[model samples]
Target: MPIIDTHCHLDNIQYQDDVDTVIQTALNEGIEAILIPGADPKDLPRAKMLAEKYPEVYFAAGVHPYDCENYDLDILKTYITHPKCIAVGECGLDYFRLPEDEIEKAENIALQKKIFIDQINFAKDVKKPLIVHIRDASDDSKTILMQHNAKEVGGVLHCFNASEHLLPLSEHNFYFSVGGVITFKNAKKLVDILPKIPLNKLIVETDGPYLTPHPFRGTRNEPKYTNNVVTKISEILSMSKSEVSKLTTENAKKLFKEFDIKN
Candidate 1:
């Protein structure tokens, strides 16, 4: 039952009061490791601290699309050098919440693309894998990734939205990270696409503090809940739970290439 939550936000305020307990519970449940993504510059320190405090914890250094407005490459570069920083993102295009004003929306899209491209280049420069986050901007995201030759360093599309258009990325060294959303009733699209994703490129995430799996949707998400994700994936792929766990854990290690699973 060894598992790795490749994208939980342990730095989120939701876990401020009891992150230790949450992490220990995850460990007790057989989640071997957790990677906190850097969505906010303010949280990178906290993420780093947690990674230092717990051997099972690691983190990525990059801003989310929603937080691109505050993007600062120099600031992110500092965290990129940390020994515990495993990847370069959670960064990419997100068009789900563009402004109503056409002009403002256009400007916003441009900024996100700029930030996204900058981060991609930065990842390449640092020679680290990326943890991409693409939403309604799939077309743009795929185009940018291809145009920029992101395959050089490789990466994972965190919370992969099941857009068939992005499937070709598999050939370019990209992996797809499925999260708790797969357990939802409306995840038919993702469920169907799951089998299509090359098993070698498949990994799992909780995306904790958000997208909590069923049987606990409204409650705050935590790394411990990755069990539900593994269960649903096993059912969807018709594989044993341990098989899913082993394969995904290996996929994560192959991509992140930072920490090793401790016995």
Candidate 2:
């Protein structure tokens, strides 16, 4: 079975010069499919274009918390209905870069929360799974997901942060997406938590243009690096690389039902 990179920012400027080559390289290397997440509304068009041009590419439509200030539901709705647009997000709370001023930080958090909740509801309304992005605000993200009854739509926690608090989400129809960060030496926390995640809830991502895996840590990331992530996961889970790839690809297809993998 081939691997699936469930979350990759192929629309980023980093791939502007040679995206076609990048996609072909990943396909040649056994990466069966790639998902382009919507971080900024400005990038959704580019994402959609890539998805339309490549049969193996699909996309999601939602704003990242950092771009919450520009969250416009109307604009997102335009892309959400695309045949290749399979999920609702890359959206959630990101408290990693809040303002230094207490008042500014509070306001920023409020805006992020509001936008996150709105997206969650939108996903439910559309009856599509979500591609959530949670950072340092795991508690808030978990609470919001539960309160909003996000289980109705389920989701993949893009780049799961090894937070024990989120493990129970597996029962709520949420899957944990492991990425290149798992190969980092300092990723002991995630390494330790790897086996704790239910195998069925496991999926893989590259989060390309960021979190490039080890031995290539300083370089740009691409979907082909999903192979590195699968290798690390197989080692941690005491399974073969093919086993890990099959399971993760199955989990991804389960969550993003629109994925039309022929093989």
What's the TM-score of every candidate structure? 0.98, 0.99
Q: C-alpha displacement of 61 in model 2, angstroms?
A: 0.3
Clash counts for all predictions: 0, 0
Tens-digit per-residue lDDT, 72-119, candidate 1: 888898899988898998899889899999999999999999999998
Question: How does model 1 fare in lDDT?
Answer: 0.92
Q: Provide the lDDT at 21 for model 1.
A: 98
- lDDT for each residue of candidate 2 in 154-225, tens digit (9 for 90 to 100): 999995579989999999999999999999999999999999999999999999999999989999999999
Error of 2 at 112 (Å): 0.4
Best by lDDT: 2
Residue-level lDDT for 105 in candidate 1: 97
